[model samples]
Target: DAYGAIRANQGLYLSSWGQLGASGDQLDLTPARQQLDSAYHLSDSLSQSAQDHNADALDSRQNLKQAGDDADDRYGNSEQLSDADQSNARGATDSGGRGEAARMKAPWLHLASPAGITLSTPESTHLAQGRSLSISSGEDVNIATGKSLVASISEKLSLFVQKAGIKLFAARGKVEMQAQDGEMAFTAEKGVKVTSTEGRIEINAENGILLQSGGGYIRIEGGNIEVHCPGAADLKGAQHNFGGPTSLTRTQPEL
Candidate 1:
C-alpha cells in the first residue's frame, strides 16, 4: 500500500512506515486507512440503495398506470354488455324488428393511456374508415417507422408551417407533384425560384404562361439574349418596345 510499508520475512507481516514517510512512523496510520475504507464502503452502499429504490419506484408507477387503464376499459365494456343483454330480452318479446339492432350494438375494443392509445401487434388500427388522419399537437410530435409513409387525401389537403420552413429531399426515387384539377398555386414572402442541377428544366402550361407585375407595370432586361421562341411570336399589350437590333434580336420567326 502507498500509505504504509510492509515488513516481510514470513507469512505473517506487519504494515508500518519508515520514520521519514509522509505521516511519520511514530504517527500510526492504520486507523486512518481503515477509517477511509469504511467511509468509502458506506458511501457506495448508500448510492446503490438510492439507485435501486429509484428504479423500483419507476417500475411500480408504470405498472400502476397500466392497471388503471385496463380497469377502465373493462368497466366500459361490462356496462355496454349489461345494456345489450337488456336490449336482447326486450327484442325477444317484441316483434322481430328490434332483434337485428340488438346484435349490431357491439362495443368497440379500445385501450388508452394518459399519453396515447396503442394498438398492439394483434390489434388492427383503422383511422375513420379511410376518411382522414388528423393530429393536433401542443409542442411537437415525431414518428419513426420501418415501413413506408403514404398520404392520400381525397378532397383537399393543406399544410401551414408558421415558424420554420418545410424541405423535401429525394435520395433515390422521383418526386412527383401533380394537381388533378390542373390549378396549382404557390406564394412566398420573398420570391419563388426553381432550379435544376443535372437535368433540363421544363415548364408547360396548357393555355399559356403569364408574367405580370403588380407594383410596376413590367420590365424586361437581358444580359445577352433573353427571349427565344421557335414558332410564332406576338406582342400585344398597352405599350411595347422593340429594343435596338443586335445580333441577338430577331423580331420575325422562321416559316
Candidate 2:
C-alpha cells in the first residue's frame, strides 16, 4: 500500500524498498536464483523478482566463480568451451563479480517459535564452518541421539571446565579412554584417585608398573614386587601378609 509496492496474485507482497512478505507454504526463487556450486543457486541478475534472493546471489556468486575458475577458467583459456557455455560463464562471472562487491555478505535469518524449533531429516544433517562454530545457551544445551554420536578431528579434541568438574557417564555401557599410538597421561594439581564402586580395579601392564616418589621407587613386574629407596623404607600394617614365602635377596639396585 506504498509507492512502488506490488502484490502478486498468490498473496505475496513486495515493498518499494525491497522487503518481501509471503505467507504461502512455498515461495519459489528458482526463477531468479542459480545453483552454481551446490544443488541450489541464487543470483542477483534476477533483480526484478526478489531483492533478498538477489543479494544472496550477489554474495555467493564470487565463491562460485572462484570455484569455477578451477575448471571454467581453463575452459575459457583453452578455447574448448562452446559459444553457449561461454555465454553462460560470462553471465555467471558478471553476476559473481556483483556478488563479490559485497563479499562475505550473508542474510541474518531469524526463526522464532512460541514452543520450540525442531529440525528433522530422514537422512543426516551436516554442518560445516569456514572459521569457528560456537553454540551457547543461557540455561542448558543438550544433544541427544538414539543410536550413535561421533566426532572425528584431525588435530586435537579438548574440553575445558572453568566452574565445576567434568563427567563422563554411561548408564549401562562401558566408558573407555585409550591412547592408541601415544601416551595417556592424567595429571591433577590437588590429587588424583581411581575408584570402583562395586567392582574391582585392575591395572595390568604388558611390561611393568612403577610407582615413584622422590628418590624412592616401587616396581611390580614378573610376579614380583621390588622396592628401593635412598632413605628409609618403612612398611606399616596390623598384619603382614604375603601370597608366597618371603625371602631377602641381596643384589645391586637397578637405579
Candidate 3:
C-alpha cells in the first residue's frame, strides 16, 4: 500500500494501483532468479551453434586437384571425393552467404568484396588443372585498384576462343607480349591494321608469307620498303606500286 512504481535490472517487474504481484526478483526472489539464469545459458548454446557453421565453411585448406594430374598435396588423396565430402562443402559455403558453386571456384582467386582477403606466401600459388577457367557476370564487372595490374603466364597454348573477347588498355605504358624463341601471329576475321604515327614498323618471316586483304594477294606500304621474295609472288589489282630489287628471280602471278 506504499509503492506506486517498480524498477528492475535482473528480471521483470510491474507496479500499479496497490496490486503488485509479479514473478520478478524484486517482487518474488528465488524462482525468478533461477528461471532467468537458465534462459541466459540457453541463448548461449544457440549462438555457439551458429558459430560452428561459420567455422565449418572456412576451416578448409586442403590440397585442391583436378582431373588427370599428379599430386601436389601429400596429405590429401588424389581419388574422387565422397558424398559426405560434397555435403560438407555445401554447408561450408552457405555459411558465408554463398552457394555450393563457391567451392569449385576457390583454386583460382575469385575474390569479390570490399575489404577483400590476402594470400601471402614465399612460394607460388599454382592452378595446375587441365580444365578451363571461366568468369561471368550478368552486368559489367570491374576490377580496379590504385596500383597496376600485372599478370605473368609462363606457358602459351592456343590463347583465343571464338565468341569470346578480351580487351586491355594501358593509360601510361606499353602493352607488350614476348614469345621467347617463337613467333607471334595475329589474325582477324574482318581486317587487320598496323599503324604508327612517329615510329617505324617491320615484319620479318623466315618461311613464305601469305596475306589476305583488300582484293589482293600481297599489299605493302612503306617509306623505303624492302621485300625479299624468292619462290613466287601473286599480286591481284588493277594498279600496284611495287618496288623491289631489279634482279628479282622467278616472280610469277598465280592468277
Candidate 4:
C-alpha cells in the first residue's frame, strides 16, 4: 500500500513540477557523483604510501654514512702506533756497538807477543824476555831481560838489564839504567847513565848528565856527569837521581 502511494505522488508531482525544472541533462547527476568519490579516495591512499617509502630510504642512507665515518677513524689510529715501534728498535742497536769498542782500548792490561812486540799506550809498560826485545810507547817503559834488549820511548823509561846486555835503539825521553851483577849498555839522544848496581853500566848520550858506578863502574863517555867506582855508588843520570850504599867490591866483573 505504501509503495503504491509513493508512486502515485511522484507521478503527479513530476507532471506538474518537473516541467518547471531547467532541463533533462541537468537533472541526471547520480553517475558523475559516484565516479568522483571513487577517484578522490584512491588518490589519497596512494600519496600516503609514497611518503612512508621515502622516509625509510632517507633513514637507511644516514646509517650508511655514519658507519663509513667510524671505520676511517679506526684506521688512522693504527697507522700512528706502527710507526712509533719501528723507531725504538733501531736506536738500541747503535748504542751497543760503541760500548764494546771502549772496553777493548783500556790501558791497564799487559800485552805480550813473541818475534818482537809492538805496543802503543798512554801509560807505562814492562817487558821481560830472553831474546832481543823491542818496545814503543807514549809513556814510561821498564825492561828487565836475561839477554840483549832494545827500547824506544816518547816519555821517561827505567831500564834494568841482567848479566847479559842491553842496546837502546832509540829514545825520545829520559833513560835510567841499573845493571845488577851484569854489564848493561845504552845510548840516548838526551841523557843516559847508571844509578847504583852490583854490575858495570856503560852509557852514551848527546845531552850529557851525571853518571856514577858503585860495586860496578858506571861509564859515560859524553854525558853530563860520569863516575866509576868499585861498590854501589849513587849515579845521577839524565832526569833521574839514585841513592844507596855500596857492597863488597870484586876485582873480576860479575857479568
> Using lDDT as the measure, which candidate wins?
2
Candidates sorted by lDDT, best first: 2, 1, 3, 4
Say which prediction, candidate 2 or candidate 3, comes out ahead on TM-score. Answer: 2
lDDT of 3 by residue, 53-100 (tens): 431211111121221011111221223344223223333333442212
Tens-digit per-residue lDDT, 147-223, candidate 2 = 89898899666444434678888899888677777788777779788999999997766567899989899998776
TM-score, candidate number 4: 0.12
Give the Cα lDDT of each candidate: 0.40, 0.46, 0.38, 0.35
TM-scores for all candidates: the values are 0.36, 0.45, 0.30, 0.12
Flag regions of model 4 displaced more than 4 Å.
1-25, 55-255
Error of 3 at 30 (Å): 45
Error of 1 at 153 (Å): 2.7
Comparing candidate 1 with candidate 4, which one achieves the higher lDDT?
1
Better of 1 and 2 by lDDT: 2
Task: Give a tens-digit lDDT track for model 4, residues 165-242.
Answer: 566544454454565454565456676655655566653333344534345544533422355566555647678756
TM-score of predicted structure 3: 0.30
Which candidate number has the best TM-score? 2
